[model samples]
Target chain A: QKEVEQDPGPLSVPEGAIVSLNCTYSNSAFQYFMWYRQYSRKGPELLMYTYSSGNKEDGRFTAQVDKSSKYISLFIRDSQPSDSATYLCATGSNAGNNRKLIWGLGTSLAVNP
Target chain B: GAGVSQSPRYKVAKRGQDVALRCDPISGHVSLFWYQQALGQGPEFLTYFQNEAQLDKSGLPSDRFFAERPEGSVSTLKIQRTQQEDSAVYLCASSFRRGAPYNEQFFGPGTRLTVL
Candidate 1:
């Protein structure tokens, strides 16, 4: 099984809708979870970052992690057309010197007007 | 301040050809990383460099893939005898510090390599 799994969604939603993107991992050693947004033909930019479990909120976006279940989520409030992009989830462990992240296939999102 | 920048924004190579992709990281960043992203997929780790030292390269798919950061600044990823499956976007990222929890990597626009 892949260490991290995310639905590669072409999820379409209207403007102002609340959007929830999620990912699940099989590795319990993962300690850091991150969410990134990528536009077409562009590299991904970090959107939210969280360590361990619990929740971190940044303006209209909130990131939540459940270490027990190995689940992570990013929620966007009042989504806009500009928010249309691919959302990728990544997990990292503190083990050893290899800090390489395990990433999931991104979910493509389109927020229409 | 400029973010990470990668040269040869786009490249096309025939199968079995070699290609070099360059990354100019943000000045003063201590850590550098290389990732490969295939179509409709998330970026996969290729290698990591702390300054001029290569710390991890387990992600390199084969011996044909190589990366180096000399002088602790600019880095290059060279693919020798590329295959059609090698077509992907190569991304570079840099962070101000070493390791996670303290380092937040800023990514470059990436180089799109098309192997035909």
Candidate 2:
């Protein structure tokens, strides 16, 4: 099984709608979860990061992790046209040689005005 | 402060030719990383460096791939005898500190390499 899995969504949503992006992992050792936003032709920019489980909120974005279920999510409230981009979920562990993050195939989001 | 930057935002090379990609990391970041992102895929780890000391390069796909961060700042990834399968975006990232929890790597605008 792939270490991390995410839906490669070209999801289209209207403005002001709520957008949820998610990923699941098989590794139980993953202790850090993060979300990244990438626009066309640009490198990914870190949007949110969380350690362990629970929720971390910054402005209109919220990141949630459930270690028990091995699931992670990024919620975008009041989505705007500016929110149109690809969303990637990543996980990391401090164990062994896991200094690098395991990434999922990003989901493409298009928020129409 | 400036973000990480990469040179030759785009590169095209013939199969069997060698290509060198450059990365200028954010100043003073002790940890540097290289990743490969194919079309429609998330970036995959290729190598990691702590200053001039390379800590992990197991992520490199083959012996043809090599990387170095000389002087503990600027880095270069060289693909010898590039193949068509090597076509992908080569991304470079750097973090402020060492270890995992602090590995919030700041990425550069990757160099898109196309091997024809």
Candidate 3:
């Protein structure tokens, strides 16, 4: 099984709707979870980052992590057309030789105006 | 401040040919990383460098893939005898400090490679 699993969603929603993107990781050793936004033909940019469990909020975006279940999520409020992009989840471990991030298949989102 | 910059924004190579991609990381950043992203897929780790030292390269797909950071600033990824499967966007990222997993990596626009 892949270390990280995310649904490749071409999810479309109207503007002002709430959007939730999630991923599940198999490695319990993962201590850091991150969300990245990638536009077409562009490299990904860091959107949100969280360590261990709980939630971190940044403006309209909130990142939640549940270490017990190895599940992570990014919630976007009042989604806008500009928010249309692919959201990727990545997990990383601080242990030996495991510094590289394990990424999941990104979820594609399109917020129509 | 400029983010990471990669040269040859786009490249096309015939199968069996060699191609070299360059990355100019954020100045003074101690960590550099290379990732490959296929169409409709997320970026996959390729290799990482801390200064001039390559701390982890286990992610490299094969011997044909090689990356170097001789001066600790600019880095290069060389693919020898590229195959059709090598076609993908090569991304370069850098962070201000070492132990990259804990830091946020700023990425370049990336080099889109097409191996025919």
* TM per candidate: 0.98, 0.98, 0.97
- Cα lDDT of model 3 by residue, B26-87, tens digit: 99998899999999988899998989999899889999999999999999999999999999
Instruction: List, residue by residue over B31-62, the lDDT tens digit for candidate 2.
Output: 88999999999999999888898888989999
C-alpha lDDT values of all predictions: 0.92, 0.92, 0.92
**lDDT (tens digit, per residue) of candidate 3 on A1-113:** 88999999899999999999999999888889999999988888999999868999999999999999889999999999999999999888778645577899999999999
lDDT of 1 at B71: 94
> Evaluated on chain B only, what are the TM-scores of all the candidate structures, in order?
0.96, 0.96, 0.96
> Which residue runs does candidate 3 get wrong by more than 4 Å?
B99-101
For candidate 1, report its TM-score.
Answer: 0.98
Candidate 2 true-interface contact recovery: 0.64
Candidate 2: TM-score of chain A is: 0.97
DockQ values for all predictions? 0.73, 0.74, 0.70
Instruction: Grade the docking of candidate 3.
Output: medium
Alpha carbon lDDT of residue B44, candidate 2? Answer: 95
RMSD of each: 0.9, 1.0, 1.1
